[model samples]
Target: MGKPLSGKVTVVTGGSRGLGREMVLAFAEAGADVVIASRKLDACVALAEEVTKKTGQRALPVACNVGEWEQCENLAEAAYEEFGVVDVLVNNAGMSLLYPSLEQVSEAMFDKVMATNLKGPFRLSALIGTRMAAAGGGSIVNISSIEAAHPEPLAVPYAAAKAGLEALSVGLAHTYGPGVRVNTIRCGPFDTDIAKAWPPELRAELARHTALKRIGGPADIVGAALFFASDASAYCTGATLALDGGFR
Candidate 1:
């Protein structure tokens, strides 16, 4: 019942849709000025307005492709310029490439998945974590996937990339400690429109196997995210809070 994160400034990548959008809104509701970023300017701007209106919190909208290092740099700079400092970062920009097999996968397709799903978060966390260290301390939450653990064959690139992200989270914590916390949230099939290529039957199957017996909405992730960004999880670092509802 404590408003533990009052006045904190947090940044969320991919804030235009899905879990990212929900987190940005949740952070605002919890009394944090949020910086929302996405590849689309209109989307980020729109979410910024919505967060401002809904939660009465300061929201800064930024356009950036997290896959590119330079764009990630600009995002951090823009957020800092808008809010003076950032206390939390959510590296949530990601996508998956579903192919039948490794033979069917194009190098370009594999690279795209790896770059966006893994390197993007790595780069963004690096830049933001640096800023956080300079400022004394901060929290970084990277959105990973249960696929990293379960390893879906059709999504080889995705699973591998997310696995790398989880690895980075653990490795990063050792380097960024005393003042910074780095963690990953291994998420399952969310109800966001993000799974455009996933067959409906497969989605249903995924839902059926989970202990919760349902696909989670964006809201299902808000509580864990808030804990990561707030003082509630001050002792947590180098951890992956599996948001998969205990799927097999």
Candidate 2:
């Protein structure tokens, strides 16, 4: 089979580690030049090198804290400056800080979570999706969390932000339709680096609740990501695909 993303350029926020890193590598292997954006320059640089070595596709590493609006603009500018056009964009950068209780959650913590999970995607999609529509067409894949639907007490703010992200995807699809497609991948508990911080019982509980009886692996995300980013889902837009191993 031919490379699915040949001659395409993709940008992935948080493209340095975990699910983001996996997606970056997968996109490159599928024949797409990639722009890897994250807060850590070193990690992004290393992954960029690996991508070039493994797939011979050019990779641009950019340091960006998606929680800030200016940084999001800079990321978009850098990608366009380096690659002329971007065919795919993956909004995968997100965070949820721990707190003693909902009542004790600080304003800063709440804002940071909202900014990273919701605001950043909004800005990037606005900037790039507009260009994509004008230039012809493109795909935008948003990485959301199942917590948006099944909100837990400990993660209410994060869940709210994710819910907003899903809503944003639907709105963006309409805002840039016919030429640009926007979609969301609602993810469940995956055994990514972040899962290492999860307690054992929490992990077991999550697994038991899923029909798959196991948490997701890093590679589990590749199929859905490719589908949304490529022509495999050509007619699909404003849709949400659950990648949670049937988490209930």
| Candidate with maximal lDDT | 2
Question: How many clashing pairs does model 1 include?
Answer: 0
Check candidate 1 and list the clashing pairs: none
Tens digits of per-residue lDDT, candidate 2, 1-248, equal: 88899999999999999999999999999999999999999999999999999999999999999989999999999999999999999999999989989999999999999999999999999999999999999999999999999999999999999999999999999999999999999999999989999999999999999999999999999999999999999999999999999999
Q: What is the C-alpha lDDT of each candidate?
A: 0.89, 0.97
Candidate 1 local distance difference test against the native:
0.89
Q: Cα miss at 214, model 1 (Å)?
A: 1.0
**What tens digits encode model 1's per-residue C-alpha lDDT throughout 80-132?**
88888999999899988667779999999988998898888888888889889
> Which segments of model 1 are wrong by more than 4 Å?
195-200
List residue ranges in candidate 2 displaced over 4 A. Answer: none
